[model samples]
Target: MHSIHNRLFLLFLSCMMALLIIGSYLYYRSTTEIIHDKIGDMAEKNISQTAGLFDLLLEGYDSVTKSLNSNYELLRLLELRDKETNPAASANMERSITNILGAAFYSREDIIGIHVVTHKGKLYNYEKRFAGVIDPGFTDTDWFKKLKDSSGEMVWMGLYDGSVINTMQKEAVFVFGRQLYDLDTYKKIGVVFIETDPKPIWAAMSNVTISPNSRVYIANNENRIIATTEKDGVETPSFSGLPRPDSDHVIVDKSTDQLIVAAKAELADWTVFGLTPKADINAQVVEARKYLLIVVLLLVVMSTALATLISRNIASPLKLLIRQMRQVEMGNFTGTVNVNSFEEINSLVSSFNRMVHRMDELIERITLASISEKNAELQALQSQVNPHFLYNTLDMIYWMLDERENDRLGRVILALSHMFRYSSDWQEASRTTLRQELDQMRHYLTIIENRLEGRVRTEIRIDDAWLDVMLPKMTIQPIIENAVKSGLEPLNRPGLLQVYTRTTQRELCIVIEDNGIGMDERTLTELQTALSDGSSAIRGNEGHVSAANGGTAGDRAVMKRRGIGLPNVHRRIVLMFGEQYGLRIESKEGAGTTVTIAMPLPSKGRKIDEHTDR
Candidate 1:
């Protein structure tokens, strides 16, 4: 046992096991105590608040009974009931008494009915319409007897499953009654019973519970449960030796697996108890302890393996260096390697750390240089687009002149001049407002309408509010030209090209739709694939354009030569923003094509709301 290996093994195992067990016990004890105190306090406060609410509710019922008890007209009407000998007069007296009862019934929403029963066996009720006929034998009921014995005071009869006065009233109700007496005679004239729905009482009890499985009980001064949230057949725990009626403090009973918090409802002369299963309260603590055990076991096993590793391996520093080297090979060069060992090994580690530092610096420089070169190339490609577009515009002018179409030649020339000026401002042309871009597009459209002889109709439905949004210059014109030439030109019908904007929470989309000869599936697929090819776009290679709209070889060649416009725009948008913002295209054989340019919305989007509200 004194051997170095055996001694170290036992020492490590014992120390780890002791520390883990002690720490876990401490954590478990602290956690359990905290949860118990916190949950008990919360439950106590909840019951107290609920009890206060019940006090207020019962006080309202007391006030309602007091109002009926002291009303002079009601007492006089009841007294006149005995004196009226004629049948019709007696019936009128009964109506007057019910009228007073109806006033009280309407004052409160919870009241199901207001009932008055006299010693002469006369019954008057002001209840809900269609409440069914009154029970004639209600005078003989136990509740009526209890109310008759009350000394001109309100008697809360707790909750019942039905009304004693109405035959068909079977819903749960909270009932209270009071004896009405004449002011001068101090004599009992009749007894008033107010039957109200028990929803308010149930709500008060439910509000005091901590969990869905927790049971709340309301017990009278005699320790008899008057109202409870316990379901039928569910046994309730005994609440023996609860706090006195005058005590405001809660009595916390911690049994084997249950926690009971009891508080007194001072005004109602009742006790409210919330019984919650301790299993629900300690569920989280148990889970934490289970995880602690698992972690402790894992640590013990790892400690044993570490002791064996230290005993067997004398070159731990070299092993650490090798691990760091493998991490470097995986391209994680963030942390340096430091090891205490022989001079030669330490020297080697120092050299490795220097190498990693230099390599990390070189990698950062290369990344930045690559980004700069990419940006320069994108700028060059955008510069090439303007001259190419100018050549096409001049070619259109030449054709019009050659065909002796002199009527619209001046209009085309004017629009061309405006477009040339707009395109020449290349210093800040990398980005411009959407309004400027649309203005340039309008000029181009003017020339197009003249060149195509009204064969193409352009509609720009962009809201004026979106005019200030900034985008790359010449973005819309290139797409418009492509649509007019490739899609609208070959159409047998008049082409309608529409431009509009759509928005969402994350992005805004500019949609260009054309009711023209749309591309077939093969051609559309090829175009989409070319646009997504970043390498080809960065290398500025002319991508292949498939035969579109069932056109001929010459048509395919024209499209092939002009396909770079879309790719250029897609690449520029992605390079400016990120990979997520780009163009999306949808087309069907004869259903036309919709090209949508999706980009992030502005920071404020104050202009967006102007159109979105519509």
Candidate 2:
């Protein structure tokens, strides 16, 4: 979760997907509306053109009806037929009427037949050859009555399977008729009916098809579907449910699953309606959506790839910089971050490099100054101890030589020579092993035992295993020397000094305990307080060393004449290790004093030289 690459990739991907989804939705919405509107408009225009074509065809039919109705010769024959009484003469007049009807039928090729019925019940018919004979009840038919009722106006009788006046003429026909009148008298003499093939009307409706599944219908004023392109038994919508037709403009109704485009034909009481299923209408839109989806998918893939690449580009350099920073934290400041990346990241890396370099320099300077300070303090403390200790040792040897102690003279000189050699050499190391410190202490004790003539005694009970532990040079010598002067020298009885080692889980302790008259509580408290106050290791001892008995000022002066005391040793140990490891003193008036030096437990083969100046 802390990985920057994953975070950046997810952030970029989410933003891109959101934009793509919103943009696609908006574009698709607008496109669908535009396509739907365009398709509807095209269908309406097609249906309107078909209606206009039907108007032309109907106009031709109307002209044919007018020519026959207004012909003077045809009217003269009809009048002659009505006036004649003889059967043979009336038959000839009938033939003359038949010739006139035959000529009118031949004038128009679409016309299937022409029939004229006089007001006196005589009929003249001219029709296709082999057409069926006329029906005897033709005058009693609804179409004939409608024609009679028309006052010289044409009446359209829609479509029929055969001629209205002829029986068994099974070809579909479009029929229309008008009452014939004598122009001068303005009187109706008879009704004329013309039958034409309905194929041209059907072609007009079919020619404007918008789709393969589209159905075209010719609906009348009453919304009855008179003609349609749909096959029989195919389900069709109720025309009454469609919007009312307007002759001046096309109307589109989308109340159903089909797209309905309708317009009224100019010359007839008919509306041409085109119905196309919505599925077919939106097929193009579906295809467009498919392509759009493909494009979106491709874009998404590209966006993901780009996001991953950018995240990696930005995060890779930052990760490298973090690794370098961690190395610095581990005290390895030598490494520098180097990468080719964006300008901002490069700048950050440059700043980090500069910081590492500056830190390395500052730490080196601080370490040098600390080491100088520690060396100066060690030199000062060593200077304070050597003069007083050397004088005391030399004076003891002078006394021994004066008393003519010839037998022990060589041993005392040998011990004094070793002590001077060990203490005066400050060029090498300022620390020594516990075994070496103990050996030096043994040499000093031997001299003390000889001087006091067995009045003072010493016991060293350190384990051989702890002999290899390292501590500061002169660490044990001063503490043992101070114990001999302050506690054992004033003893009225034989004095005993013991040195032993103790161990805990985290630290090792060197306990130097002496059987002598110990200091009082006030002195012990003052000594402890001096240790806690971080007393300087090389400071003068006027206030630090208190008298061992009765807290006398002369005793304090005598102690001052001695070497550096436990407080300076405690200060040195605390500086070398940390504050947690230091010196603790337990002493009671008239009882023995125990000075326990506490130090860290170093692992096997561990070197502590680096902490000498700490």
TM-scores, one per candidate: 0.49, 0.59
lDDT per residue (tens digit) for residues 1-614 in model 2? 67999999999999999999999999888889998899988888888889999889889888888998888988988988899899999888888788878887888789998888888887877888545777888788887898999997667777887778777788888888899999989888898888998999888888767778889888787776667788778887787878767778889877788898889887878888898999997898998899899999999999999999999999999999999988988999899999999999999999999989978866764564356335544544455456447756766775777578675764666576567667766567667789999988987887788888888888889988788787767778767766777778888899988999999987889998987788787778777787787555423343224223223456665544334455556655765676787788788888878888888876556664334334
Q: Total clashing residue pairs per candidate?
A: 0, 0
Error of 1 at 36 (Å): 1.1
Query: Candidate 1, residues 545-565: lDDT per residue as tens digits?
Result: 211133334765555332235
Model 2: number of backbone collisions: 0
Q: Which candidate leads in TM-score?
A: 2
Q: Candidate 2: give the clashing pairs.
A: none
Q: Ten consecutive residues with minimal summed lDDT in candidate 1? A: 539-548
Model 2 alpha-carbon drift over 4 Å, by segment: 82-103, 106-109, 165-169, 371-614
Predicted structure 1, TM vs. truth: 0.49
